[model samples]
Target: MKQTRISVLAVFLVLAMATAALAATEVRMVGDALVYGSFFSNRNFTGWNAPAWTSATPTWSKAGKKTEEAFEIWERFRLRTDFVANEAVKFRLEMKVEDTWGHGTFTAANPEVAIMIYGAYLQFKLPCTDVDVTAGLQNVALPQSKMFYGSPVFGDRMAALVVKAPLIDKTLSVMAGYGRLIDTNRTYDTTTTQVADELDAYFLALPITLDGFKATPWGAVAVAGKDANLFTLKSSQQNSSFYADNLTSAGTYATPKLWKNDQNAFWWAGGAFEVSALDPVKFYADVIYGAGAESDRKKSHRSGWFMDAGVEYTGWDVLTPKAYGWWSTGEDGSTANGSERMPMIRPNWGPGNSFLFDDSQELVKNSNMGMSPVGSWGLGVTLDDVSFVQKLTHRLTFLFVNGTNSARAIRTLNTLMGSNPYFQMGRDLTINEHVYGVNFDNKYMIYENLSAVVETGWAHGEFQQSVWGHSLVNQSRNGDTWKVSFGLSYKF
Candidate 1:
């Protein structure tokens, strides 16, 4: 049962690291490493094959496929380590190295390379009361407001059993965790491959901070023991060659899984703040309210919600000025369970909060979006600590998008080749097309821990309807997409 529930906490953290190597309060060890290299370029291509809006010729390709180009080259690396044994024990281990920008060597004929375990936590401090107990495979964030737990799009490690207490002053803190998003190892399919575990959660949160501004009231849940009880949500790292799944009739292929029924057992509750009466002109407003999921019509009830408000003007630390708006609540995905859609349990935004659309855009830089997503406003600034360069920092954004055909939130391509093939999977071949973008990013700290990033954007898709009238019968079109990115961030 999950390795006997973490093997007695890994044998009590190796017996407290052998009593901290013979007590002396010295046994300390620290290390850190992170490297990020990226490059992504794109140009004119309507969400993968543009041109379509016909039935009487009002123009465009209507499925003729035109104007396309793309590129990608990314590299990421991480190697962290910490193992103190003093002032209240500690231990962490992160590793994800084994990279080679474009591969040329470093081939020990398969001396093994993939050794991932994002983190191996174990922090301590709980003998009489100051409570603080963390256990293995960690990295779970949620003070909400990334549109329901985000960061690298919920790609932030999770394998919990954590607790930290201090509620009622001492800065008011509280956290409770739990995990095991899914489990299935029927030893190789011991009969129809059943035997599922699921688990998944975040029992509660409370990081209050009255006047200092920093509120975090949270709650999350998910359960589904046994596969048939259903609860997929997949996409938790299963590259499968960057999204696969298209071979049924017994061939079976699909797996980025964003939804799987068995209904009711998903929850969300939120409150993330940082307003402090608008200090240097900064304000934030986060809102959330969710209710289960597991409906494909037939008696619907997978409720939904999401919101993010914003403002920033940082009293000119180097030119700051911003504005924001966000919303997530749309569905008509017409089954495959998208009706329960709530950003599909969020995470994955950025790229101007997803006008970079897909998972449904909501940008603060980037995120992978699109399940009933919305982004109406976002004006930006912050030119940098410039004057000569004080660890440079530049940002500029402007995006406005209207949701819907975030590619039919997929649902098997909007229920079988969207843009309306049998039904109006959003009528008009799929809708969505009011994008307007512009962004310029910059980050430079070339020294002291090394950092350097560059981002670029240019957009124009306008097409919420217009092919003469009702647009022939939608199939999603409207083009003009541009991008450029470059990065190098290192820390040690």
Candidate 2:
């Protein structure tokens, strides 16, 4: 696999060099720098005693006090060279890096380096149409948030071909590609060396505009060979009572075997409509259905759907605040019907690590879990002004998520928590969960090209059980977790 990847990269490099030599053009370089830092405080650091309780005993001291802090520096540089010919062809190369520096439990496990072909492709102009082809790492094109069937967190380094055609005064577009999905191999203490097989994906979309309204319909599909080791957990219950003893007795616990039908497939179709039917009031709505199944064998089929609708009242002339909300639900083959999916979470050392949830296994299970729906809705407000300092934006959102069945939720939570060795002695945390939160984000221009942002968030969750799967001494109905965060960011 290593040799194959090297050869493929070498071939692309040779092709790019040959193309560059054939066309003489000027090369331009672009770069950007960002510095981010955050701090967090939780009422229940280890999900033990809640509210405000004093540490009269040292045992309580070891259980309740928790705080986190972190810092990240990210930089990206790219080179673009445009050819000075009739059939202009452009070449681009980009590199990015994220450096994690600070003191925190979570920040210690962050990836030290992530190097890949950001975006590399070729474009040619024709008399009646334009054609663009990409043959390296790239991102997928989908509607809305790409939550249903899009790659938002990672990029695919593959060969892609895209074509655009104009007909009946309307434009049509199509694209298809095959590439290896990049999977990061990092742990709290060490990194692994492995690469999975290649995956294939394709997409089609059409856009039209009439009378200040635009509509787009898109469809996409993706397929990959069974690479369960790429995404599966090494242990069935990481934090379970079965973990430590198994490791001590047998050297390790038995991990679940990836099914033969592990080869995965997904399809999605949806449309987005934005209308100016109302003078100052614009409406937007979209819906999508996606499914993933075992391509190699036949047993269980998984599917999910997403729907979003909202209205924007821009007629508020000076202070135009738009309110919008969206909902997404999916089932990975990990759970059976009427089972709840549990999220596998690991405690981080710092605020930076604490913010990100380790839902990879749960997400995968959601794709295969019989049929479960997870939904969340939020409302936001934005202020758009022409003034120097007033050109700022602010939004407040309320999000709610819950599983349909208590049984399914329990199973999922069990699987997620069970996969971790730390929580092996106990069962997965199960509770009727409800969350309420508020967010504040601001952008201030300190200089001509330099800007700064100060963002903060406060969220609280009420759960029936403790995160450690321990039953409360008193069967009180009210047990909740509180989270607070503040951050500063600078861009240049």
* lDDT on C-alpha atoms for all candidate structures: 0.47, 0.38
Model 1, runs deviating above 4 Å: 1-81, 85-89, 92-137, 140-153, 157-159, 162-177, 180-263, 266-292, 295-299, 302-330, 333-343, 349-430, 436-445, 452-492
lDDT of 2 by residue, 26-66 (tens): 55445554444543333232333222212211011122223
lDDT of 1 by residue, 1-492 (tens): 354345446545645865666565444433434333332332322333322323211112333244333543444555565667666787776655444434422234532233445678888898867888888788666665432235222435567887989878667888988866445442454576444434455567888877747778787776533242122232323110011010000001123233344333656787878765667776766776665544422323345566677666667655755666666554454443434334233244333323343322211222121222321323332242333467786666675655543343434443333332111211112335455566576777788877776666666554433221233223234435556556566666
TM-score, model 2 to reference: 0.62
lDDT of 1: 0.47
Worst 10 residues of 2 by lDDT: 344-353
